[model samples]
Target chain A: MTSIRRRQVIAGLAMAPFISRYPLASKILGRLVIIGGGFAGATLARFAKALEPRLGVTLIEARSRYTACPMSNLVLAGERELNQQTFDYKALAEAGVQVIQDYAVDVDGAQQRVILQGGERVEYDRLVLAPGVQLNFDQLSGYSRQGAQDMPHAWQAGAQTTLLRRQLQAMPDDGLAIISVPPAPYRCPPGPYERASLMASYFKQAKPKARILILDSNDRFSKQALFQQGWQDLYGDTIRWQSASNDGRVNRVEPASMRVHTDFDTYQPDVANIIPPQQAGDIAHRAGVTDSSGWCPVESVSFESNRQPNIHVIGDAAIAAPMPKSAFAANAQAKVCAIALVRLFRGIRPEPTVLANTCYSYLKPGHAISIAGAYRTDNGEFSAIAAASGASPIDATQALRQQEAAHAADWFSAIIQETFG
Target chain B: MGRYHAILPMLVLGLTPCGYAQGAPSALSQSASQAAVCSGCHGKLSGVAVPALVSDARVLEQQMLALRQEGGDSAMHRLIHAYDETQIRGIAEALASQKNPPAAQSTGP
Candidate 1:
């Protein structure tokens, strides 16, 4: 053969094997099972299914409907309705996810299967947990399941909000209202403070003399500066924030009596919002996926639990910081977790992941405040990478507040749409 | 032709059976041939850090979808994104049919 032809022949011989190998790669990928239908589970399901139509996805949600906790407090202040924050399982179905409206009884990671409360078994190659927060009501004395019926914390975003709304509407002018804020490291760190601010805005109108006394267990809080400025400008002296050292700090609540107290005095209020301590949900610890601290310990960057391989943790149940326990943070972590899951399946190493979260609190119709941060994994730890990430100025002008309010609503809507829609 | 070598592995990956390429690739019609491909790369400090596919077809499918997109997760986004749907599912089933060790060690959460 000629020299050029000989070179071509040699290359063709090598190419023959590859031409033959290309048609046989269709039937070898792994499946994934995700628990909890909240932001983490829902977003993960959509993204994964969209990417690979054949990857088997089954989302197990304990409840039929998902009520967004991000905007639930707005229901109390009458800014949004209950329906606005609610969603069904239809979206997951559209994305080819098998949606099970059942509770997860046990995760036999060893068996590579999940046992449902109804006794059904579903297997998975990998598992993702977004089981959300478990309120530690037991940590606070005198707080019971029944007590929440009368004194609603409105923390879980559905009926609790409605109950609180009804109680608020029933109060007459000059009535006293008490809101108890939990200590640090809870879901949605700024939630309780935002609730207080929104409540103060509501009280400023209907019953101007109605006092809102916030009894905080911690001295520092979420969106402290913005909430303070909002209360000062909107409700002025009508709202009082009492920290742990304050005389009116709340130790406990007598839900039935509608009473809350501190060292020096007792107040019988028309409404009491008693938010309790929190921890990872039962499903996480029950699987031996968490340590004694009641939180799931995981590799910070990949967001994978240290307790088990093939089981990844996200959202309120997992320890991902310095990101707050907000929906935005959970959504960001889900993206990183998805990438990790994919790389493992494909026999490729995953590139380092960088995640970002910005939480905004709306003070009123057009006024808003926000906190922003970006994070990445370094030396196997997920830490805040953006040193300048922080909240909007406390005494922000109305124009700045207006701009933030618009951006905040848009961000919230885009994320919710990305997650459940 | 040499440039195509890099892309051919992905195409041949889960196409016929797991490891039907002792010489070059061949059409592995029997379940036994498929099993042979499955055992080739699964288990014991396997290159993939994920739980060993261990021939668990059902588990394979779920993880495939979980890693497919951003919400699905970010750790393996680019690699998972590389495969087409059928290839992903095929790999899930092929690997799932193999026997995994009692426990495969993993490095991530």
Candidate 2:
């Protein structure tokens, strides 16, 4: 940790020449306000301050504590606890970021101020919205916030995670649990499948007769081949996955009866996890940054909102195609945005950047698979570098899978430290 | 020393010359920003399986270039293929120049 601090100091010192190049930058005392203290916003706030201490960075988060979504599936499977997934903004605040525990109700783009739910107006020289994704319950018929209490989506990873876990615990030995997956462009593309895998593993011990059914709205998922191989090798017939083309798109939910309706049939499962389709958080829409697709469009390099000037969007809120909305992707995007913002403040063009993402999914305890890709800005959009992108081989040995699982755990620990520790 | 060594000359020829000249201060700064991406996984505080990214520039560069040429489906191999020799060298130097505390322990998984 001392070395990390020393490296941060060196990074700060290395920026001296760039600041000296623009005389005004040395005296610039700009305010950078970021909304949502999740992976992207918190990382951006810390990195921006580390890069330029003079920049007054403020992070506005609604929740006093953040519940991470990355490894929350393990919580549902009784492999991990919810507290392990929860983090606070103390470290970020200690790093000189003004952590505001208040909800941002609206953004006055013209006035360059954010109106909080507590009826306070905070001004900013540059604003960033990293509000992650808002679960669009309306997109799924008969599913509302109230309905989610009965059939927990568990997507946001706190109370809902506990709710789902309790439901699984209460289920009978031979009961069936259904995981309804939304379409693509949602946060954590491979998440629901991992949930199924872990739940199957849990049931293999606790309720060996129980089964899992994945009703996916997409035809395919991230790391599909490897996940299928793992499912076959480990879980056998314990888990069943249905794609959208096979009438797997969940259209409605009868939460009172715990039934999920698909085009061909209705599943009256003992437990239901309905992950709803999503869009940018409400603040992005209020800020007029989101397009008709319900996600904010941004320039690939700086993540500046295409709709509004001086307001950047990162993480799941931004339409960074070819970059899945994983925690690692969000972290990488936040750093790139921080670097771009620092250079922009000094009147230097943001350098061309290479963004990378690696997502690991546990198939069972001590077994996992992964997918990795590197992306670059090509013709004003984010494009994957084909030569550098692939998933784990289907024929990987058990030892390799165990090693990947270890890497997965290490990755979660490392990213948690990078974001909050 | 086969196809991996054969691709070295082409990779060198395709290098971006301006920001990556050896020992250039600007190169360090630029690569520092780029290397921030690595912190998401390869943090300073090493993990049980993932090693802390504290190594000499030459060693780091050689490891990355070799991973790129090995052409496997492993995460490191896939990610390492993203950079050319110059960018890899810059990132290597930037990470190598960081001061590692004397007590920092090195362990293998």
- Superposing all C-alpha atoms, what RMSD in Å does each candidate have to the true structure? 18.2, 7.8
lDDT by residue for model 1 (A1-421), tens? 0111222334656443211111224663667788898878887776566535556677878777788887676778888899888877776777577776677888888977777774556677789988998888888778888999988878898888899998888898888888888777788833877777777778877778898888888887767876887888887887788888776456677888888877777888888999888888888987779888788988865577898988999988988778788887777677556656666666655545445566777776557777766565657776775442566776657776776665555445555555665
Per-residue lDDT for B62 in model 1?
58
Off by over 4 Å in 1: A1-28, A247-249, A263-265, B1-109
Candidate 2 docking DockQ: 0.29
Quote model 2's TM-score: 0.87
DockQ for each numbered candidate: 0.02, 0.29
Best by TM-score: 2
- Deviation in angstroms for A143 in model 1? 0.8
Q: Evaluated with lDDT, which candidate comes out highest?
A: 2
Rate residue A157 of model 2 by lDDT. Answer: 87
Error of 1 at A175 (Å): 1.1
- Chain A of model 1 scored by TM-score: 0.90
lDDT by residue (A347-413, candidate 2, tens digit) is 7888777888999999987788898999986467999999889988888888878767876775676
